[model samples]
Target: MRYSPNHKLETKEKLLESSSVSAKKSGFATVGVDGLMKAIGLSGGAFYSHFSSKDELFAAIVERELCQSLARLGGHGEQDCARLERCLKHYLSMAHVEQPESGCALPALGAEIARSDILVRQQAEIWICRLQESWARILDSDSLAWAILSQCIGALVVARMLATADIQRTVLQSSQEEIGRQIAGRQQAICK
Candidate 1:
């Protein structure tokens, strides 16, 4: 039976959402088209209706996930340093470290993203640069913005790799402390 156009759109949406979460939680390269389709209650053959290939879906996922990261971490163009400070605190928190599927795609999928085709990598670059630009405006220093952005993503990856919560917390706290020191040294009271 033929479904409504809306049904098709909705199914595609569900597939993207579910598949992205699955990819983030368990590297995208690990799952097949059939598995991704199954997560959305569709047959593997139906995958062609939404995307030409898994690579196409991956590009879409990269765009969707990074767009979300930009929105969450990039804040409005208000130049409020505190906005980034607050975001950093939560970003380096245990909750984010514990939830790969629901957190930023960078740490969980960065390796996979790096290995993806040029187009997917470019899509990630666009959003990442946008996020950096947002922070650069707030911090008034491109160097600091890049450093903090890299540090935050790295800290999360480190925290998640440890086998114990104490060590994970330490990794996060150290990064948070270092980030605080960096911001303070460059622009004292900027985030206060």
Candidate 2:
């Protein structure tokens, strides 16, 4: 049966969406093409139709996930401090940590990307730079933005590794407060 171009496009989008969420929730390397295809009600052979290889699919997923994450967390039009604060609150919350599939891609899949091919890693680098620039604009200091980004990503990674919810919350709360203090300190200096 020959599917229309629109139908094929729709199917491909569905596969990308589902595969992205699954990869974020569980490391991309761990999700097999067969299982990902099955999740979207497509045969394993259909995977090749959308992507030449798993690496290609992974590159696409990285690009999609990172763009979505930036839109959600980058705080496009809000004031600088407010945007930074909002991002910190949402990113460091227990809810974000608990729902890896729907959360930021950095903490969820950073390790896997580090091990992936140049194409995938390049995609990750592009998004990371975009995020840093977004934060830098709000924070008014590229150094501080880099620090906050590093801290936020590291905190999430550590929080997720802990055994208990209480520990995870502690890690998140501490990082959030610390970042907040840094921002506040900078603002105060600017006001003085």
Worst 10 residues of 1 by lDDT: 183-192
The model with the greatest lDDT is 1
Tens digits of per-residue lDDT for model 1, 1-192? 987969988998999999989988998989999999888777999999899999999999999999999999998877477667889999999999988999999999999899999999999999999999999998889989999999999999988899999999999999989998887776774545
Q: Candidate 2 residues 36-92, lDDT tens each?
A: 999999899999988999999989989999999888767775757966698689899
What's the lDDT for candidate 2? 0.89
Indicate the TM-score of model 2: 0.95
lDDT agreement with native, every candidate: 0.91, 0.89
Task: Tell me model 1's lDDT, rounded to 2 decimals.
Answer: 0.91
Q: For model 2, where is the 10-residue window of minimal lDDT?
A: 75-84
Q: How many pairs of residues collide in model 2? A: 0
Off by over 4 Å in 2: none
